[model samples]
Target: MHGFAARDDVVRSGAPEDDDTVLRILVVEDDEGDAVLVREHLQDGGLPHETVWVRTVDDALSHLAASDCVLLDLGLPDAMGLGALQRVLAAGAPPVVVLTGLSDTDAGVEAVAAGAQDYLVKGDVGPDLLARAVRYAVQRRRLEDTGRALYQSLVRAAETTRLERALLPTPAVRDPRLEVRVGYRAGRDGLLGGDFYDVVERPDGTVLVMVGDVCGHGPDEAALGATLRTAWRTLVLAGIGADEILELLERVLAAERARPEIFTTVSMLAVHPDRRTADLYLAGHPVPLRLGPPSALLPAGQRGRALGIPVGGGWPAERLELGDRWRLLFYTDGLLEATVGDGTQRLGKAGLLEVADRTLRGDVETDGAVRPDEDPVVGMLLSGVRARHGGDLVDDAAVVLVGWGG
Candidate 1:
């Protein structure tokens, strides 16, 4: 190749009319005659090619970095064959095409695998072959970059999954009288949607449990839900009542929200271990169902709107007895958002209760008989909704069942 000369022959911009014109190529061949021949062929084949020859690997690395394409000769004084190609690829050079002699076919194959776009045999290739190879190599590298970006996105999603699990709160309870079971599923699959739950055992021996759903589904909403759950637990530990806790949550939701439209629905359950009495508070959240001998849907009494709405509004609270061995189920709205038909009608609270009752009594007719010993009440309720929709719930669904087994 010709000695290093600071010339402006290569690396020119595209024409004004052809804004997306052909790319400029830099030929890094140590042999001066071979480099001249390659440039002649590229020019004859109607390629926008430029030759910048460097006898040593150091000069080649610097020159290739600015070039759109490279034609590298495997045999060089400083680096030979695969070693030189390795240095070029390691230096983060653009797409390169190896110039190999007829005797070094194996070396050429290795160079291509090591990261060269393509390889051509010396003393045999024509102008069209040279031009086509360069164009195709550049296109292939572009596609490879795209694939790498998509893989990175999947990696980020996997990392988010780990973060979501870590954020799930473990119930804090010392009283052996209460057995709390909590579960959550995001409605928009593959993302951490805004749904959260927590259980905290305060210093006063009272168990505080909560489940909430933020208005929108996105990272911002999920993050807000996480923040609210942590704050609620902290306030409960600080000795706040169910009613006051919900009110404070509303204030926090109002202050910390990213947008004015963002709101949250929450249900708080506080149980006294000694008395077996519980207080329920709801702010636009689904009323938890009681599963026991009475097995009925308890009212949450959400007199006020959801959090972040009409900021600082308060809601009414209700007191109920667990009796003995009663189970409470808390869930988000994704479970009830299913449409009964093509119309605007939805399987709302009443319809959900009817399904639960029928499932418990084994009166809801289906193709198969009720499985023996299976929790048919909850199972049937979920199944009924899925059946209506013809498959899994279209929206994300989450459930937390707290059983006060005496």
Candidate 2:
């Protein structure tokens, strides 16, 4: 108003009005003349906007609940300089543009560096300039918000990956004669579940193997699975008797589980030093498949109740005779429970046996020997399951293979 004689003409030439894109601005200015001038200029800009003027930083913050961008005068009745900016930022930090006197332009620059979207010198701004600055400030603030959100997501992803790596068990057996292979796939949620497995060779020359699944799909369940696997490894390494191991594990699960409803299904095998026999223990788990000249589920009468159930007697350990050149497969229920094709029917134990038979037949060499470098059995089984489910598994699957003599 001070520089222009007829303000009405300037308002008409600023921009075309659009009701749908009207901006709401909150102006914090103590001086009545300056406040009127700002309101007139914004109206003259012809960029449909609703302006609410406040004389103090406190009043500006109160109006912010309904306002989009804040046009703040650094010099106010209650707050001055960067102090006013700091208060506004502390209260939610919406998009902001600072108003400064021509002589205090350096302060305006500092305000921009300190999180203000943009700044303007009071005497130098026209209706068009004011509207443009407000539009650009909102855009810049949105970009910054989006970038910050993306960075946080990347950080969470990295942390989840690290946790998953820590939970996976590495084979501790050094025996070249005992070949061990494993396969694991997370569920559709893109997060690791409670499925876990471990293989360890004791000093007594016995190879201990285990595959277990806690009853859930989440970070908490995954962490619990890791704890159980670690505890089992520690007990086996410390020469804990195979007969007492499951009972001890039951105690650990009871103590460590987050809720009473949570339970774990586990299958364990302890192959003797002679590699001639092994002990099989099932805790409400699928029986281990014995791959021979014929592949089939081993005869396990009445699989034991899952761990965490109140049972007096421990899980019955059955003796398994493992002659020369034998392979045993242990896995979580996810493998057998996966849906096959587009049907509601699941790929049960029978389907798994079929897959295993196919994988073995395909992996054998013409010379009547199995390939040693790669584990085609578990790999093919997982690939087949994924293909049947259209490349998205509903649950996490884990498989471990223990073999002696070719």
Leading candidate by TM-score: 2
* TM-score, cand. 1: 0.62
Model 1: ten consecutive residues of lowest lDDT: 7-16
Query: Residue 87, candidate 2: how far off, in angstroms?
Result: 5.0
What does candidate 2's lDDT look like per residue over 1-406, in tens digits? 4332221112122234566676778878877688778878887776677777777887777777777789999998789999999999999857999999999999999999998999999999998999889989988888988999999989978877776655566789989988899878788887889998999998889999999999989989988888898888889988999888988998899999999999999999989999989889999999989975368998797368899987655678888877887999998888788887676889888877877776677742122222353356666767766665556578898899999984
User: Model 2 residue 224 lDDT?
Assistant: 89
Q: How accurate locally, in lDDT, is each candidate? A: 0.73, 0.82
lDDT of 1 by residue, 1-406 (tens): 3233443234232223332655767777777678767876777777664556566677777787667788888898888989988898888888989999999889889988888989999887788999899888888888898999999999988867765654466678777767666555444365777788888888777777788888877778778877888888889888877668877887788888998888888887887765378888888888888864335688655456677777565777688866766778787787778667763777776666665567567666442422353344545656665555555455655566677656
Report lDDT (Cα) of residue 127, candidate 1: 87
